[model samples]
Target chain A: MTSATKTLELLSFFSEQHPEIGLSQFCKLTSRDKATTYRHLQSLEIVGFIEKNPLTKKYRMGPAVLPLAQIRERTVPRKSAAKASVEQLADATGETAHVSVLSGTTLYSLVAVESPKHSTRAIVDLKTLPLHATASGICTLAYGPDILTQTAKQNLERFTAKTQTTEQGLDAAIQRVKETGFSHSKGSIEEDIYGLSAPLFDQSGTIAGAVSVASVATRFNADAERTIKHQLILASRQISHNWGGSIPNPIEACWSKTLAET
Target chain B: MTSATKTLELLSFFSEQHPEIGLSQFCKLTSRDKATTYRHLQSLEIVGFIEKNPLTKKYRMGPAVLPLAQIRERTVPRKSAAKASVEQLADATGETAHVSVLSGTTLYSLVAVESPKHSTRAIVDLKTLPLHATASGICTLAYGPDILTQTAKQNLERFTAKTQTTEQGLDAAIQRVKETGFSHSKGSIEEDIYGLSAPLFDQSGTIAGAVSVASVATRFNADAERTIKHQLILASRQISHNWGGSIPNPIEACWSKTLAET
Candidate 1:
């Protein structure tokens, strides 16, 4: 790598897993001499990309990134971050794919994409998804804040007969979603729709939203469901990463187990 | 500067003033050739430090900074960010220096430093500063949210004879602070403490807190006041920059006019 590229790569090392790095740890991580690593670090420090902690004498990310992150958010909003990932998920699944964000306890649709491969695929027409009647809502209740469960219970609007209209049924659905790492709803919100979803997270490491594939019920089979689940995982990972978060290990393990069984 | 340093300097070029830059603008700003500037931009883009707007084709900050900023806040908390600046302010002004943060309508002291220049110095003993009786609280009322005015009027307790006890007196004090860019109080919160404060901002471009230098009443004179104001401006700027903000232009102009008059 070029010297500039190498210096820039040093920033990527300061992540959630490793928030601070001492000079020796930097040297060990990069497999470089202390002098070389220190020089690169100085370059970053001079530009306020890295700061040395006074108490621990370790280097951490500096305050400069806060303003840069603000600018990035203004220039490229969260909706745009998920647009490409949703498009890719729709293309891969040959069905309708969408991303939703939770504000308070309500799940709002951010963006949606539909595949050209399907002549009559599911269409996303709702602005806000009911917390107890959709796959995305179930995924959110399974992973989001505890208060969301109370909110979901209070608004158990029955969109269809299959929708969980009682708190007991909603709790059961949420329990299944927690175990499977994917939420599934058959004819819940819509009579002809089968929705499968995975939770999305943001920098706060909490469940920020969900990514889902809503397919036509008649076209949904065991093979299609397996394919949709795989693509949903990819979409969830991509969207979460784009939003500056990663999938938690437990959810990833659940997906692995569910895929193994599938 | 090394090539790495030069490339990293490119990140500093982005600010609230110039959030986006075209290729020609980058070349002009760095005084480098187009090819060299493009190479540096490419290096930053490869590491996700800079991203080009697909429509405008102008480069702005990337999503990577969000995670880095989050990590920075975790490793080096806001209290730590203000600690060094407050210490420097105390040393420069030879007085007690402190920072107060606004949460909702209440202002709470974050840190305090005593210069040890005198046998007797002002002590910051309060956990929460009264909104109507202290220089730091007045500074917050001047620049913080409008609801703060109502909050201040609701509880105008008289601590000392010079404290602004009436609504009209509080309004006059706030108006003067807005015009002068500094808040001043003589024996308001304490019997013998003279407090002068400047507002501090954060990445939100709003008043997050105030940096104040509290002097002993007997030690306060015109010369000491002038020197304290100068140091207060520096402390405010440093603390605000450390908190990922800059002094607004109008506030900077107000400081300049006040200093020039003094």
Candidate 2:
């Protein structure tokens, strides 16, 4: 990799998971010559991104870079929108509801709330996902903007028994998402897991991201598909509207599907 | 001041009150030439400390800077020792309890907790104050490493009506802090507010910081001053012990003062 990319990679070493590292360890981790790592560290230090412990000589992220995390406290983008709509989705279906948005190639949880009666829960980490398998990712791929075409071309790792691996099958699924204005996958990402997702469009007319209510597939069987599909579309429309998203004639789009909700 | 000091002075332009600044306006605010200001911005940006909006060109702090705030979130430096004691301080006083540690000439907040009672709310902001009048600053001034002698010799901004301008008077106050192991002030640095503070040493026997409880003097008068002082010193000692700081019998030092326990 280029020196610039290596420098960026060194910066990534200071993640929330591992906020501090030492000089020798960082050099070993990056597989850099000690001198190269030292140079990058010096450059980073001069600019105030990373700091060394004056007493210990170990490095942690510096005080100069703290404003970013504090602002996330003020603005969790689309989180409020997702919470409002996901509740409605759960009320309609009696299943867990959550909102996950694409971050880099993976998905991140904005926020999540469960149905009042559900006994089991979907476990997840925010902003960590394999792109090809998740319902929210599939929705974005199918009806997502031009970006979906590129993601599908990358390695589609099969994570579970029902993961869609073939490029043609994934394309067909995307086609289905376009037709239905929502996406569904059962046991595709996790065993026995079912998810229904719909895109939340922004004012710029791009599919900003998606909202999904997930549960075990047994709770949402073949007989419940139409009802669940209708709820997903309605909830997505509500969220898009609240976020100042311009979804022109959203109800009319739902009418194009076999749903009577429109 | 040198260019580096001027660059440090640029921080005065940003505060809890006004976090965002336009580049053009920042040039005017800093009184630095456009090229010089641009250079500062470039250095700041390179460190991932700040980011400018591509469209608006307005600069707010960047996301990569959050770990600095995280360090302060531990609330108490030595959690097992300090956390419970500090909470007791807040409960006893019905005011905000704060601990600020020296970061060069400036003080940085390590922990802050609001009072439990809604009526006696706290007005604590993590803004730095000069080491001249504020009780915590005075406590640190009184008991800090010999650096206080060096700092006071150089930069002592006369901040308030209660601010001590003369070196001799300030030295007496510092001598009082070292002797008494606590500091008290009434409407000195800020109007209508009174504060009690005591210094805390770390396990290594270095001046770690000062813990303070502040309240409106109207509720806590000269009669209540004895009680506030009592609580502050006790809490500070307890927290210091928690920090593994064997500060030569701090609790005994509190007993000698007229500050009575309830």
Candidate 3:
């Protein structure tokens, strides 16, 4: 095979199973001679697709990769889950359901659906939902700054009557999520829309994301809170188990403020 | 920055908005000299990240890139779109939801969710599903032999009462997907579960992947026929639109296949 093909194959070698690899192992995987592998590795390193550990000499994907992957994955788009649980949630509550991620402060939409009878064929545009307003954002805020940092870069935008643009306001919002194990957002992004979000953790003890049940406010009132909360928690656990995401500790996003200065 | 870095910066220039660029214009995008840009382009071209059209002399991402992006964007280990989607779909349906890619006559799962109510999550272990048994795999069968030839490499395996093992059955299955906009398999991949799936197309008019919702016999009965058919059409359309895919004319996939094979 050509050196170019070997270099390209090098990236594929680093996957969720093995995000980092030693030079010798990489050479073995790619079936390239050591010298040839090292030479191309240098080319890849210079190009910012990879970085080498000074200590172990292992290589992992670099920062440059994240932006490209993020944008492409988002624009490229698409969803499903621990299905039985979601079905139960729908059967129990009869509301639209969703799970989402935070990308640069926008609620990067992941997946969602509504009951066919009540389903209005919703269009949850996989665009950014501002952090100050959605249940999904509160979960990210409760975990840490990675979500907020992305949001801050976009400069918080207020879209409706319930919008909160200040840092302090966002902090207060996440605190509520930490205390309740779920967050409730009322029409912050869209008028008359109310959503309850809970954290979905990864195997690594991180908040992988948040799952929320959305309903028009008239239907999600206080009388329905207990049932809704129960379903949301159950759905979150099912998805976390499906994902093998661990429940990470609550975050102190004040660090996010510090990072923002950087 | 180095010449290699500059070359990469040029790539950032290509987005969903702009996918190809000319020589002098490419140099302008990178702010490098004509000669220097030519040399850097040659280095990148030699490595197969980008290609220069011998006719137009313009550059676009090369063949080596497509699969890397596919594996990274689809099969890579990171938390991705399918993960988020399955989680939401599970909560919405109380059934299992999943996403998979065609892999050697089987569908390799990138994501899946378990149902909350089902005492048994028939799909705890996620991996390749037989081509004839799975909703995702049958949907994938809609594509031409170029892709099916790759899938047929698996030789297929029979799982339950309805799994297709022979090449003729598999070919007929592909023909079924072509005749119908959707495909269904009963008690195939797993016993007592009914499966339904639809083709997911990419912007360039290729089958990118498939999404599916599955259920036990009781849950996926006649009432399901209407609900699932409606949601499947909607869900597939949402994802295909995200990939910039339009409703494909069967003949177009045929033309693309002929050109690609030649």
Candidate 4:
């Protein structure tokens, strides 16, 4: 990677769980020496991408990101267009529903809502979903850019026993997603969570992202899966239409066949 | 600036008005050569900070910022905490209400709502509010960090005829804000907009940002000014409380005296 790109990459280490990172913690996380890590932090800090907390001296996300996100929404309003559908999906499925946007090879979490019906739920706390370990990632691999398959192959970090850690296993999962028009991952990212995802399209007529329902594994039976898939199709179409694209006929056919056969 | 800082600074050029920017346009805007600008754009694009539009090839903000913004809101929640109050201020005052947060030396626009009560209104379409010109900036200068005054004096970019371009003029305006517990700028940023703002505080017990109402200059008479000032105090208090802060005694006294005298 270029030096600048490497510097920017440090930001990805932050997540809702690890919202603040001290310099030494960052160094350990990135597996880089303290000097290089500190310099990268300095670069990010100067641009207001990160700021040090007064009391803890740890760095958290800075305010500079607000305007960029606002401009991004104003330019292509993805979140506002998808929020209602995701909320409805969550309500219908009685699980956590979310939208992710495919930018380059990564699927960045856009918006997520969790249903209050269940006492136990799957929390979509990840900033970026693993392309091999999550339903959303598999959905993107089935319909997104071709190079994403190669990208997913290069990093097959195992999250659970069910996560595909080999190229052959990953490819088989992706092929299943293509035939079913939905991607399902049972205890891949987390041991007790099941995720079902449908691809979302944008004006460019390409797979722009995925709408996903993450459910508690114990509650995800065949009937629950059917209900989730039905809601996912409706949400995919609603969000895709709002984003100025339509569900392709082949994917529609796959959905019809899969639903009928099941 | 470091090379990474310089590269990341390229993102600041994007706004609601100029969302997409071409490589040549970026070069012209920053007065840099083609090769360096392209490399910087490449760096930003590689990290998904900016992406090229397929049809236009112009670079706009990418999906990467969405996650960062989400993390920031999750950490600080400045927007959600401030949104309803700003909307209420807009509704009560019948003007454009906005909130800005001070990040380092810049006052970044956090959230804004325009009242539908007026056909013609001031649009708060800025990414960063100028510290020497806007009411929000002046309010920050009055009550925020001591160094902000020096920062504002150094830039002194004149946005309109009424903008304080000199240190003396700017200091005088800040003094007015400190004494009255409010900042008022008439046609300072835009020719026909009058902005009145009050400082917002956070858990740190210091000025965190400002909540302001911008109205068309033609409609900003004494009666309207009284209404806006009355609503601004309530809005600022409400937002500050939601942000885990309260109006300081001196500022509250100033507000009481200003309201009582006016």
| lDDT (tens digit, per residue) of candidate 3 on A55-148 | 4578866434433433333332223334445556666777777777544445676766675646442335656655667777776777756546
lDDT of each: 0.90, 0.65, 0.62, 0.88
Candidates by DockQ, descending order: 1, 4, 2, 3
Q: Which parts of model 3 are misplaced by more than 4 Å?
A: A1-262, B1-79, B103-106, B117-121, B144-156, B202-205, B237-262
DockQ of every candidate: 0.62, 0.05, 0.04, 0.21
Q: Candidate 3 chain A, which ten residues in sequence have the lowest lDDT sum?
A: A250-259
Which model scores highest in DockQ?
A: 1
Q: How do these models rank on TM-score, best leading?
A: 1, 4, 2, 3
Better of 2 and 3 by TM-score: 2
Model 1, A1-262: lDDT tens digits are: 7899988788878876788889999888889889989999998888778888888899988877888787766666789889988999999999999999998988999999989997999999999999899999999999987899998888778788798898999899999998999999999999999999999998778999999999999999999999999999999998888787889999999999999998
Q: B117-232 in candidate 3: lDDT tens per residue?
A: 67754463667766556777777766634567455546666687677777778677777667666677777777878877767664445676787878787666676665665566
If you superpose only chain B onto the true chain B, what TM-score does each candidate give?
Answer: 0.94, 0.62, 0.59, 0.72
Which wins on lDDT, candidate 1 or candidate 4? 1
Question: Residues B1-62, candidate 2, lDDT per residue (tens digit)?
Answer: 33433443454455434666787888898777888777676655554445565546776554
Model 1, runs deviating above 4 Å: A166-172, A260-262, B15-19
Native contact fraction per model: 0.71, 0.10, 0.08, 0.54
The candidate that achieves the highest TM-score relative to the unseen native structure: 1
- CA deviation > 4 Å runs, candidate 4: A79-262, B79-262
* lDDT digits (tens) for residues B57-155 of candidate 4: 899887678767667767767786688789899999989999999989999999999999989999988999999899999999999777888877878
What does candidate 4's lDDT look like per residue over A1-262, in tens digits?
7778988888888777788889998887778899988998999988778877766788888767766776776787888768878999999998999999999998999999999999899899999999999999999999976799999999999898888899999889989999999999999999999999999986456899999999998988999999999999999998886564678999999999999987
Error of 4 at B150 (Å): 38
- Whole-model lDDT, candidate 3? 0.62
